[model samples]
Structures are given as C-alpha cells and as structure tokens.
Target: MPILQPIGRTLLIFFAAAGRLSMFAANGLSHCVRPPLYFRLIARQMIDIGYYSLPVVGLTAIFTGMVLALQSYTGFARFAAESAIPNVVVISITRELGPVLAGLMVAGRVGAAMAAEIGTMRVTEQIDALDTLATNPFKYLVAPRLIAGITTLPILVFIADIIGVFGGYVVSIYKLGFNPTTYLKNTVDFVQTEDVVSGLVKAAVFGFLITLMGCYHGYNSKGGAQGVGAATTNAVVSASILILCCNYFITEMFFAR
Candidate 1:
C-alpha cells in the first residue's frame, strides 16, 4: 500500500500538470484565432525567433552537414559505397537533421528567453497589471508568440535544409574529391518534395511545442527570482525533450511503411 501510494501520487501529479498544460494551450490557441490581432507584436517575435536566429541555425546546419558527409563517407568506404554519400547527406539533412537541430537550437535560445521574460513579468505583477489595465494577457502575450513560432520555424528549417545540403556538397566535392556535378545530380535526384515537406511540418510542430512550454512555465511561475530562473530552465529542457519526442512520432507518421 505504501509503494502504491507513491506511484499513485506521481501519476496524479503528472495528470494534473498535463491538464494544466492543455488548458494553457487551449487558451493561447483560442486567443490566436479570435483577436484584434497584434500584428506589430507578432512581427517583433518573428524577427526575434526567425531572423535573429538565422546565424546560429545556419552555422549549426552547415557544420552538421559537413560532419555527416565525412562520417558517412568513412562508414561507406569500408564497403566501397562512397557513391551513396551525396544521397545520404541530402536525405538526412532534409528529412531529419535540419529540422531537429534547428528546433533544438531555437529551443535553447528562444525558449529560455521567453520563459525568463514572461516569468519576470509574472513575478513582478506586471501580468496582473495587464488585467487591471483591461489588456488580455493571453492575446497580447501568448498569441503573438504562438503565431510567430508557427510561422517562422518552417522558414528557418527550409533555409537550414539548403545550407545543410550545401555544406555536404562542399565537403563531398572539395574534401572527398567527388565530382561536384555527380554529387549534385545524385542529391537532386534522390531527394523528394515529401522529404522537405515532412521536415517543415516537424518544424511547425516543434515551434508550437517550444513556445507552448515556455509560455506555460512562465505564465505559471511563482516566487520571485529563483522561480523565474527555474521556469527558464524548465522551459528549455521541456521544449527540447518535446522536440525530440515529436520528431520521432512525426517521422513515423510520414515514413512508417
């Protein structure tokens, strides 16, 4: 009975947290649909989430592609399957690496920021002030972020796909001594629209999860500085975990023969 009690308590807490998150998500999404939409706030979030994030995401994608090409070549060389490197690189970048890596990078950078900012507002009573001032915090705060996240991550991942593929191209041709023309041909011929589309879909889902986690943690945060800090950490960690978990489910949905 004692052991069962602990297990039951854990399950209860889990369900409670899930329920709260669902409620928060519902409210945020509802606000997103019905609104005197804040285009200016959404635009600012877009710049913060997408444009400012480009350099880090681009660098990560390029280096990832280069490393993947090199590693694939090494593995395939044993079987003299080097010709498959280009196909492997392109398919990998478009189907998995680009979206997943970009999602993680953005989660770390943007999720933490969102949590910290909102948590600060929460702890400082600014959110309460919004209520007093007749401003709907959900619409003003959460919806714009949600909109920007959903809209921008796909664009970021698309650019990452290009940069990643280019990285592999550079490595294959310059470092591996492969014929540039043949590598490009294989890459072009092997990759399909579905691959890129699937990645973009994953990006959108990831974006939503990231913003959702950040907003949920921050909005619910209590205490003062310590609580805000904890929220920031939880936001990043939760978003990253959700990104990986969703990546698997999304991939299975898209490619599960």
Candidate 2:
C-alpha cells in the first residue's frame, strides 16, 4: 500500500505538471501573438542566452567529438572497418550527439539560470510589482526568452556540429594516425544536407523546450528561496528529459524510413 501510494503520487504530480505546462504554453502563444513586441528584451536574451553560451557549448562539442572518434576507432578496428571512421564520426555527431549535447549543456547552464532569475523575481514580489506597473509579465519576461531560445539553439547546434567534426578530425589524424586528407574527404562526401538539417531542427525544438520549462517553473514558483531552488532543479531536469525524448522522435521522423 505504501509503495502504491508513492507511485500514485508521482503519477499525480506528473499529470498536474503536464496540465500546467499546457496552459502555460497556451498563454505564451497568446501573448506572443498579441504582444507589445519586446524586441529589445528579445535581443538582450539572444546575447545572454546565445552569445554568452557559446564557449561552453563549443568546448563540450570538441571534447565529445574527440572522445567519440577515439572510441569508435577502437570498436571499428576490431571489425576491420577502419575506413568508415569519417562517415561514422560525421553522422553520429551531426545526427544526434551534437544537438543533444548542446541542449543538455544549455539546459544545465541557461535553463537553471533562467529559472533562478525568474524564480527570484517571483519570490521578491517583483513580478507582482510588474503587474501593478501595467506591464505584462509574459511579454516582458517570457516572450523574449522563448524567441531567443528558438533563434539561438539552432545556431549553437550548427557550431557544435562543426566543432565536433573537427574534433573527430584531429583525433583521427593526430592521435589515431589516420590520413588527414582522406579523413576530410570522406567526412565531406558522406555527410548529407539532411543530417545537418535534422540536427538544426532538433536544436530549435530543444531550445524552445529548455526555455519553456525554465520560464514555466520559475513563473509558477512558490515558497521562497527553497522554492526557487526547486524550480531551477526542475527546469534543468525537465528540459534535459524532454530534449532526449524529442530527439528520438525527431530522429525517427527524419531517418527511420
């Protein structure tokens, strides 16, 4: 009975959260269409979320590619498929790993930050103050972050894909003793436009999911500092989970023919 109670409670919370999230999204869409158009806020979010996030995303991408190449090389060598290294590396990075890693990193970094910031605002009565001052909190706070996320994630993923491939290139050539010229040639020839497009699409969806989760949790935060902390944690966890789930569906849609 105790175990069943816990499981039931967990399911209840999940459904409640999902319902709130649906309403939150609908509110956001309505505000987005009827906005006073906060372009300045959107631009600021772009710089903060996109520009400031570049270094971490790039570093993660490079290291991921390098490590993947090393491991894939070791595995492929056993099957005597060494020449396929470039193809595998490029496809793996561009199709799934690059966008997924970028999204996870951004969720950990940007999502938590957004949730904390907004949660703080909520607890401090600052959001209430905004309401008193004739400002729509959704427009002022949510819209810019949502738009910035939609715009920037694809760019980050694109950069990640390139850097990850380059990392693989370096590892294959310098560390693993593969011919640089042939590696580059195979990578270029094997990587298709669809691979890149699929990654970009996934990135955009991930970006939106991350930002939405952050905004939703933070905007609805309760308690005080402890509540804010919980919201931040929830935002990161939810965003990361959603990114992984969405990535699979997107991949299936793109390539599961």
Candidate 3:
C-alpha cells in the first residue's frame, strides 16, 4: 500500500498539472481571438521571436546540414550509394532537422527569456498591478507572444530550410567531391511540397508550445527570484521536450504510411 501510494500520488500530480496547463492554454487562446487586440505588442513579439532568433537558428541549421551531409556521405559511400546523399540531406533537412533544430534553439533563447521576464513580473506584483489597471494580462502578455510565435516560427523554419539545404550543397560539392549540378538536381527532384509544408506546421506547433510553456511556468511562479530561475529553466526544458514529442506525432500524421 505504501508503494502504491507513491505511484498514485505521482499520477495525481501529473493529471493536475495537465489540467492546469490545458486551462491556461484555453484561456490564452480564447483571449487571442477577443477584441482590443494589441498589434504593437504582437509586432514586438514577432521581432523578438523571429528576427532576433534568426542568427542562432540559421547557424544551427547550416551546421546541422553540413554535418548531416558529411555523415550521410560517409555512410552511403560504404555501400556505393553515395549518389543518394543529396536526396537524403534535402529530405532530412526539409522534413525534420530544420524545424526541430530551429525550435530547440528558439526554445532555449526565447522560452527562457519569456519565463524570466514574466516570472519577474509575477514576483514583483506587476501582473497584479495590471489587474488593478483593468488590463487583462493574458491578452496583453500571453496572447501577443502566442500569436507572434505561431506566425513567426513558420517563417523562421522556411528560411532555415533554405540555409540548411544550401549548407548541404556546399559541403557535398566541396568536401565530398560531388558535382554541384547533379547534387542540386537531386535535391530539387527529391523534395516535395508536402515535406516543406509538414515542417512548417511542426514549427508553428513548436512555437506555440514554447511560448505557452514559458508563460504558464512564469505566470504560476512563486518564491521570488529563485522561482523565476526555476521557471526559466523549466520553460526551456519543457518546451524542448514538447517540441520533440510533438514533432514525432506530427511527422506520423503527415508521413506515416
């Protein structure tokens, strides 16, 4: 009975947390559709989530693509299947690596920032002050971030796909001694619109999860500065984990035969 108690308690806590998150998400998304929309705040969040994140996302994508190309060449060469390198690189990047890498990078950067900022506001009573001021904090803070995340991540992933594919092209042509024209043709011929679209969809979902986890953790934070730090860490870790988990489910939905 004692051992069963611990398992039961853990399950209870998990379900409670899940319920709270679902409610938080529903409230935030409901506010997103309501009136008094803050375009300015949304725009600011867009720049923060998208433009400011470009350098890290781009660099990660390029390096991932390059390493993937090199690794694929090494593996495929052993089987005299080196000609398939471009196809693999293009398909892998457009379908998985670009979105996943970009989402993880942004989760580390933007998710932590959102949690820290909001958790500070929570600890300092700023969020309560907004309530006194007749301003809905969810609309003003969470909605903008959520909207920006959903709208911007697809664009980020799209640009990442291009840069990633280009990186593969450079590595395959220069380091792997592959002909540029053949590699380009193979890449173009192999990639389908569904692959790119599926990746963008995953990016949008990941963006939403990142911002939502950050906001939820921060908004519910306690214990002052220490809580803020914990929330920030939780935001990044939870968002990254969710991105990976959701990526698999989304991929299954899109491509599983």
Candidate 4:
C-alpha cells in the first residue's frame, strides 16, 4: 500500500502539472491571436530574443559545423568515401543541427531571462497590479513573448544555417584540402527545399515551446525569491528538454521513411 501510494501520488502530480500547462498554453495562444497586441513590446522581445542572441548562436553553429565536418571526414574516409562530406554536412546542418543547436542556445539564454523577469514580477505582485489597473497580463506580457518567439526563431535558424554551412566549407577547403568550387556544388546539389523548410518549422515550434515554458513557470511562481529562482531553472530545463524531444519527432516526420 505504501509503494502504491507513492506511485499514485506521482502520477496525479504529473497529470495536474500537464493540465495546468495545457491551459496556460491555450490562454496565452488565444491572447496572441486576438486583437490589441502590443507590437512595440513584441518587437522589443524579438530584438532581445533574436538579435542579442546572435553571438552565442553564431559561435555555437560555427563550431558545430567545424566539428561535424571533421568528424564526417574521419568517418567517410574509412571507406574512401570522402567525397560525400559536403552532402552530409549540408543536409545534416539544414535538417537537424542548425535549428536544434540554435533552439537549445536560445532556450538557455532567453528562457532563463524570461522566467527570471516574469517570476520576479509575480513575486513582486506586479502582475496582480496590472490586473487591478485594467490591463490583461496575458495580452501585455505573454502574448508579446509568444509572438516574438515564433516569428524570430525561424530567422535566427536561417542565419545559423548559413553560418554553419560556411564553417563546414572553411574546414573542408582549408584544413581538409578540398576544392572550394566542388564542395559548394555538391552541397547545393544534395540539399533540397524540404530540408530547409522542415528545419524552419522546427525552429518556430521550438521558439513557442521555449517561451511558453518560461512564461508558465514565471507566472505561477511562489515562495518569494527562492521560488523565482526555481522557476527560472525549471524554465530553462523544460524548454531544453522540449526542444530535444520535438526535434526527434519533427525529424521523424520529415525524414523517416
């Protein structure tokens, strides 16, 4: 009976949390679609989430491309199949690595910031004050973030894709002594429109999930400062996990036979 009690408690808690998250997502999404959007706030968030994040995302993408090229070379060299490096690099970057890595990086940076800022507001009673002042917190805060996230992530991922592929190009030509013209040709020839589209779609989804998790945690925080801290941590962890899980499912949807 004691063991069963623990299992049942855990299951109940999981379901309760899931329900709350789904409701929050629905409410926030509704606000996003309805009128009275704060476009200035949305643009501000887009700059914060996308422009300020470029350095970290760019560095991560470039280094990832470099490493991927090196590793792909080492593996393909095993069978004298070195000619396949460009194809592998381009397809892999456009389809998987660029968006996933960019998502995770932004999730860590932007997600934590959102949780901390909003959680602080919650603990400080600013959200309630907004309600008292005839303002909708969801419309003012959550919607702007959700809109910015969904719109900006695709652009960020697109830039990351270019930088990553260029990184691979640099390595293949400079370090691996491959002909630049041939490498670019193979990359262009092998990659398809669907691959890029799939990645952008994944980026948009990831952006939404990241902002949603951050806002949900922040909006529901309690216990004062410690609560805000916990919310920030949860926001980043949840966003990152969702990014990886969604990455798998999206890749399967796009590429699986």
Residue 91 CA displacement from its true place in model 3, Å: 0.8
Please report the TM-score between candidate 4 and the true structure.
Answer: 0.98
RMSD of each: 0.6, 1.9, 0.8, 0.8
Candidate 1, lDDT over the whole model? 0.96
Which window of 10 residues has the lowest lDDT sum in candidate 4?
87-96
- Candidate 3 lDDT, tens digit per residue, 70-104? 99988988999999988898899989999999999
Clashing pairs for model 3 are: none
True lDDT of residue 213, candidate 1: 88
Give candidate 3 regions above 4 Å deviation.
none
Task: Write model 2 residue lDDT over 141-162, tens digit each, in one string.
Answer: 9988988898899998998999
lDDT of each: 0.96, 0.93, 0.95, 0.95
The predicted structure with the larger TM-score, 1 or 2, is 1
TM-score of 1: 0.99
Per-model TM against the reference: 0.99, 0.94, 0.98, 0.98
Could you give candidate 1's per-residue lDDT for residues 31-83 as a string of tens digits?
99995999999999999999999999999999999999999999999999999
Worst 10-residue lDDT window for candidate 2 reads 28-37
lDDT string for model 4 (123-181, tens) is 99999999999999999999999999999999999999999999999999999999999
Q: Give the candidate number with the greatest TM-score.
A: 1
